[model samples]
Target: MKRILWITLCLAVMSSCSCRQEPEQVALDFLQSFFASDYKQARVYAAPEIMGILDKSQSIFDSLTPEEHQEVKDYLSAINITVEAPEKIKGDTVRLPYRVEFSRLKEPGESFITLRREGRNWKVYALE
Candidate 1:
């Protein structure tokens, strides 16, 4: 019984530690997956509101011809995303600014990703 109790306590602490992901990290993961056209992977980091959009995007990609899909994949693979430190906006809300650097472009494009705390985890709320 004592061993069981100790094991349970350890498991609880480990779960809690692994359950929460920082908003900035979530934003970077979402951007990298989404831009890679891996909508399935990206959806895991998205909020409920954004999940539908990712689903739709996935469906569209699935409908594309092989050549078209490869072309888009090759294009996306050449781009890189850099996520900056997250800024806390308000309670449970954070803004992550990121830069998308395309190989052919002289200047990187800037965008903002918003994340709201959902229970123990931070979720991607929106992009601006």
Candidate 2:
């Protein structure tokens, strides 16, 4: 019984520790959540600076007209983003390449997303 309990505890800890998503997945998740207008969920994946920008933008977003808001939503929704594998470009920093497709446009856009390690987790540093 003691050995069984110890094994169960070890398994639980390992499972919990391994549950954190990789930086690339987190970036993709953030983009999807942001485009879906799930700001609360999206913020979880943002760095402090990004969160600050989001917080400051809240008032501006709130003041938009319904039609303007709809237009903005339409534009965001039209974007389909694909996150690529992350490469460590510098110390504790990783760069993730992504492809963005706009439904209203023909050509796709490419960009790199920068992430920094914060403790054991990674956070979005910038979208370059």
| TM-scores, each model vs. reference | 0.87, 0.80
* Cα shift from native, residue 49, model 2 (Å): 2.0
Span of 10 residues, lowest total lDDT, candidate 1 = 84-93
List per-prediction Cα lDDT, in the order shown: 0.88, 0.80
Q: Candidate 1: where is the Cα deviation over 4 Å?
A: 87-89
Question: Residue 24 of model 1: what lDDT?
Answer: 80
lDDT of 2 by residue, 45-102 (tens): 8898788766766666778999988888877887889998754446777888888898
In candidate 1 the C-alpha lDDT for residue 64 amounts to 95
Give per-residue lDDT, candidate 1, residue 51: 86
Model 2 regions more than 4 Å off:
87-91
Tens digits of lDDT, candidate 1, 1-128: 99999999999999989988888889999999998999988988889978888988899999999999999999889998988874445788888889999988999999899888888788897988
